[model samples]
Target chain A: MSAATTMVGRSIRLSRRNLDTAIMAVVLPVLMMALFVYVFGGAISSVQSYVDYVVPGIVVLCTGYGATSTAMPVADDMKKGVVDRFRSMPISGFSVLTGHVVASVARNALATFAVVLVALLMGFRPTASVGAWALAMGLLLVYVLALSWLAAGFGVIARSVESASLLGFFMLFLPYLSSAFVPVATMPPWLRAVSEHQPITPVIETVRALLTDQPVTSGRPALAWSGGLLVVAFTWATWLFRRISSR
Target chain B: MIVETEGLTKRYGTRTVLNGLDLEVAEGSVLALLGPNGAGKTTTIRVLSTLTRPDGGSARVCGFDVVRQAADVRGVISLTGQYAAVDEEQTGRENLVMIARLHRRTRPAARARASELLERFGLVDAADRRVRTYSGGMRRRLDLAMSLVARPRLLFLDEPTTGLDPVSRTTTWDAIGDLVRDGVTIFLTTQYLEEADRLADRIVVLHNGGVVADGTADALKNSVGGTRLDLTFASREEALRARSAVGGLADGPTLGLPSDGSAAHLHRVLDDLLAARIHVLRVATHRPTLDDVFTTLTAVAA
Candidate 1:
């Protein structure tokens, strides 16, 4: 437990020092939200107000960007031989992976908060009660945690930092295909199926419903997907860490 | 023994890195695993330090099995790999404190230990600077300082001075010498014969993943035939003629003859070469060093 806390502190410090990535995590999603609500929102006729609709998607997209950034640092530690140093000590691989995952969750929280603040300044309003807001944030936390662990697993397997950044590209692209920026009904039949059936779509829909104080239809699937992904990703990351570090 | 390995073997996709190797190191001694690239020096250190597992046989460190009791092994050992493992984003003090904390030191205690190590390694000036701003030698010193934060009973250094400049190398050597004085068991690997001779009480020559020679530096050197006279000739033909006339070993343009380090023996060899009409360009008596032992042992094994 001490080792885990120490690693977490170290990882947070690393994240703080990495100014470029931190800025990108917060700024990119805000810019994307502005682009969607002002530029693309006028053409879409399915939603009443695009800012309120696009804000939830931007929140999910922010988490995706933040979670995928976890992979690069994890890959750096692995390639730089620090993981070997840690493994040779009494430290467990669980602690090391936990450090990165927790830091990822923290970064996502901050970026999500920034995106929400920008949405409010741009004429977006959420009509949720306090409890609903808490529940929505809690679900977003689970999603971020799951994706971060998944990224850490990729980091362990990636041979270099450049390859690890590819995970970020995939995560950033997933939100566009989901219900983040546009309504699923507005898409082609095949893309609509993809947007409705994928994990990100359900997560975004759940958050949107909770914030808008509307009927929550996707809550169960959102929790199920996030919970299932958390289990698999945590198991996979720790297993890969143990195997690679020991070898 | 602080470290004991019997017939240890490791194969990487059919290429054996450690092939039926055997080794032992007594407590409070410096043992250097001397070998060239692909001789498995790093593998041996990795196996003993619990970073790697051997395929066959077994290894025991500080009375715990390397595979089964790996956690215990880790508890008593620290490894400094070929590369400096310090985090570039963190400051030097932070890196050291992190390691100390991982070793279960209290917050204040970890801080104190980090300060002490930074001062000892002459890194106090750069203690709060990020490792990314450090020079090569400073980073290496910080890497060593981090490894010593826990003060383990045993330390494994795999090519500790491989890429350092000459001054940094000597400073590292001095730091290692200080550790030896503190009675820590050190198992270091190096390709430089001088490093093995200077810091190791016992030098083990590894070839083809096996121990080819293991003894004190002097013992290994004596094993390669001691106190030879190096007779350099102006031409390879003259060296060959001197070798045939005086019954010595011919290498390039030099003939090496075993000598007793006496004036009479030198005179006799020069007389024999002179009578044989072999023109000698240089005459120097060479003492056997670890280089001779390493080359001779590895050459024979090859």
Candidate 2:
């Protein structure tokens, strides 16, 4: 009944009503995983178990793609003038952005689960106990939340819907550039250094270690990065949202 | 006054959109802010609706200061923008229900209100269909319905029927009429002269960031000019000849002369044309329309 809850519910309902968006959000990541694991898996040589190395990468990649879904609804709402409508109403100023971020994070969680399920069906063998799996999922969710907010910031800044939708494509490149399918060392030194420093690499590395029962301490950088990214993106998105709504 | 402003100013970058402007609208009445594009009609609505703050002056809605008490102002007013601000992906019913819920209606109440609005707007059959499937008129009606969920005392409509067909525009007008009868105050902006003429009790003509004319529609129309007899001829030379003989302004093949709207005035014009042997293709008396008022006022301001 509150403004925040109402906005979130409205966003979720809107997402549900758009059948194509739902399909694309859940299917695109799975399709990408299948293509890479089957078609490109044989060609990729750095990983001893390509499925093991690539599945975590795909999960993170899918989360990144989920950011596109987040960006689009924000852009669509802004373009349609619905943002102005919300501003004119006697509701919490932050409700609209809160709704979008919440809804996108929920949708991304489902998509991530679907990707993991497909990975399991593709013979991904995980030796981690339930606690480690929980931690991995938590870390993935924090990353998703952070990226979704970043996408939202981009969406608000974007002048057009095309620009907003395309902004998330930069996230998709993380998988290829990072040690998702291959070790960063195999890549050229410059690319390897760039890949090692980006946020996705550490998260993927952490998730991979968690799934394979490796020492989880290596993943600490992933948590720290995700937390920092969430803070920066959340702040930026809040400021952008206020600017857009007030304007 | 349901809405009041004084010395209100707004600027985007170096260009001033709304110069120091003053406005007042009484409760339970319709006030139309009429202007051409970029005349700051929308900017005024934005300020009054609490969507945008003014650069320099103060505005109040329902007695609440727009800046200091914006939340209170928002609680008393609603705005339907130039575009139908509905979610295309959501069905009409869903859109209405969502807004009702946001207004703090209970779940059942929200559903009931949504159904009521759908029926009222004649959108019942298409209520469950996505808004993208609805026609422009339907979407606009739904947009209006969404704004009405809270039953605010004052409603702001910005170019409410800019892109609608004649029939759709008529329907929208009738809907606005219903709101007026319900004792709800309406502040609407439009570029269409006839829309302001037919709907607004008081019309404010905005030009170059200020009110150029403010009065009843009839008063504004009458202030521009009086009745004139437009005589169309076969050629510009004949029109010029007629202009000299009849003593009026000439434009191409037509000579526009002021008329007293009396039988003798018509008779003398006919007699003069007959004696001059100047062929008159058409002769019609033109009453002052809001279009004339708008053109004259804006021309003077320019």
Candidate 3:
């Protein structure tokens, strides 16, 4: 009955309501994985036999790609003056952001699950134990959280809904050029260094390494980078959220 | 008075939005903030609602400081903004229930309240419909209903009837009147002078971020300085004769006399006219409206 509990419950309900789009987001990765594995698996160094290698990458990219739809909801809220309504309510200060972040993450999780099922159909399997799978899922969820916040920042700062979508697109494109799909050595020299050293590269490497029974190079480096990225992204997001919410 | 603010100033960079404003509203009285667009009306509402911090000055709602005691301030106040907050994607019923639940109403009570507000707002017919399907007027009514879910003691309405048709506006005005009757202290910002005249117990005129004028509606109308009596006659000669006898201004068949817009003043003129047997076909008093007060203040600032 207290205000705090009310906020959480309301936020959770809001999240559940919007999660209908979640199934749509998941459909994208599922379709792509199915087509790429069944139709084109024989050509151009097939990811089919080792589809597990690319599943994590596709899941992450798919999540980011679908985030373009997110900016509109936020931007629409702003344009229609719903943010002003939220500001005036006795709702919790952090609950709005919590609702948004959790909703986006939940959507991405559904999409990630679709890709995992597709990978399994293509004879792919995660070599890690259930415990490691849970850890990997945890990392994926955290990554989505930070990325969704970044998307939310763009939503607030963008002058228009179109511009907001552009920002979301730019986020997706940058990671594709990283070591998300292919090894760094496959790229030209300068891009290779950039791709290998990119923040998402270590994360992709850690997930890819886990799924394929690869040694993972101790994974200490990936953990440090992911942790630092989360802190910085969350800090920037919190600052943006506070500024935007107050305004 | 349950609410008072003095020397409240707010600035966005070099542009001052609210300048050293002062206000007082008696408990259970509806105080309407009247101003044109960009007149610091909404900004003032924001500051009091704890959505934005003022640059300087102090605001107290029910004896709670808005800045230092925001949490307590928030407990007593609620705002229904210029537009609706019901998500277009959500059903009208869901929207109302969500807000009620968020205000800590128990599940059964929240559902009951939501259904009550829906019926009261005349939204029961479309309660199952998504808000996007509702008309602008309906959505606005729903928004107002949602803010009332918690029964806040102090409610803020920022141009609550903007973009509504006359009928809708009148309906909204009636709803507001009912709230005042229930002992709610309402703070409203409106561009329509008629709204202020019709609903507000007191009016505050803000210009250039300061309180240019503040008083009851009658007092503010009086602030325009003089009331005019217009008398129209059948002939210009009659008008001229009336102007001469009354020592008033004449144009065509109309003669104007200055008065205080008081019935006693009208009685004196009527008695004098009857005693003199002055022939006049029509006589009407013209006092300044809040529109005039707004224009006068804005022009002075400019």
Candidate 4:
């Protein structure tokens, strides 16, 4: 294989290196969707398909939570002195980090598919055509890319595994507090204002609008916020990565 | 010379680990760096291997500047440490093949190189087993084998046998000896002075971030002082008398006299002992060991 292909292959291999951990990573979102949509579905919504409201949100949650596995393993790699070995090797520096982030996103995508399949079986339907669904997929992926970078920064900055894992857990909480579950309109006035403007709400609303074909009142705002947040996250992550690496 | 470090200085905040260290390792030869703990051995390795850049000064490996031409330096050298780096999750064969593949070896060539390294390191049988299952020695061997996958001309070994038992140490020594015999110039950092004595054509003693002394093993031992001839008599009186006659130091039943461990010194000592009629029950010569060289060199620096 070519050099770039081999590097990509190594990244893929490293990402799939752990099976149990990957499964554990996805389990939280799967279980959260199942419990909230089935158990708490009756109390919260007037919408016919509770599964539809929850899966996309839960997938976003999965992307954020699954980020921990990526962070901790990289932290573990540094802690175990595995990175010292890599530093001496002829391998590219960015390849391992790229491999790590890409592999994690791949696993997150799989979990998203699983959550989507379960939602579909429970009557979750996207009113968007194949192309729109593709575009929505593109949007979720961009979201995952943003989150992957944030976790990458966490992996670099964290001095311990627990601290690294906390970065992802901390990010997951933002989605729950945003307009992911109940609408921002139902929240207390102060939280409602923050939730409406928060980054997660826009991405979630965009995916929701794409899936349900509702009149997206905040459509222009959602596009700007989602795309802007991705750029900001990427910029911060790269800056963080460079700082940690230099040290 | 393939590798040269000119005044490589590394400081971590307030303390300097490597202080303006200058050294040169010739091509197709070995230069063993000997020092105690925290003597900046690993720091030097990190700088030369392109792991961590030095705070000051420069190092060239494989004749390429470690900073500006780091890619060229990286292209020609490999480093292994006290711990074997074979991924415990991957099999021994897989680890070697993975490294080989990383060097852009084709599938068949990678497999072939992995097998060859396994055979050379006496790890062919356990090649399929995950490295976690291997013994400490087995794992270290596999790590060394993986390093040789590219047949790097310059190899950096940092305390490569620190935790190994005697048998394992000997096994690693033999492997290193084989590599040296193959004309691979090895730049090794070791705590074992004896290891340096055995393997290094020239040994440089590092202490407090700089060279304390650098010479061949025997040359270093010679620089410390002449050998001492210690003789023990049954009584303090005889020891005293022998001490006066030979101009030796008498403490208890022992007499310590300097000798060059040559026939002329022995003959002169024997004549004096006979002249004094001192009945010496036991006689022994204390040649300066590598330990003596280490202690003296580091002690003076300290």
Q: TM-score of predicted model 3? A: 0.85
- Model 4 per-residue lDDT tens digits across residues A95-187: 556666777777888888888877777777767777667867887777777677667767777899888888776776888788677777788
Model 4 reaches an interface RMSD of 2.6
**Mind giving the per-residue lDDT tens digits that candidate 3 earns over A86-117?**
66666665455555666676667777877887
Per model, kept true contacts as a fraction are 0.93, 0.82, 0.61, 0.40
DockQ of 2: 0.73
Worst lDDT run of 10 residues, candidate 3 chain B, spans: B241-250
- Point out where model 4 deviates above 4 Å: A1-4, A14-17, A217-247, B228-285
Best of the two (3, 4) by TM-score: 4
User: By descending DockQ, how would the candidates be arranged?
Assistant: 2, 1, 3, 4
Interface RMSD of each: 1.0, 1.1, 2.7, 2.6
TM-score of 1: 0.92
Where does model 1 exceed 4 Å of error? B228-280
Which regions of candidate 3 fall more than 4 Å away from where they truly are? A1-24, A38-41, A46-50, A66-72, B225-285
The count of residue-pair clashes in candidate 4 stands at 0
**Which residue pairs clash in candidate 2?**
none
Docking class of 4: acceptable
Q: Which candidate number has the best lDDT?
A: 1
For model 4 chain B, where is the 10-residue window of minimal lDDT? B81-90
TM-score of chain A of each: 0.97, 0.94, 0.83, 0.87
Candidate 1 pairs with clashing backbones:
none
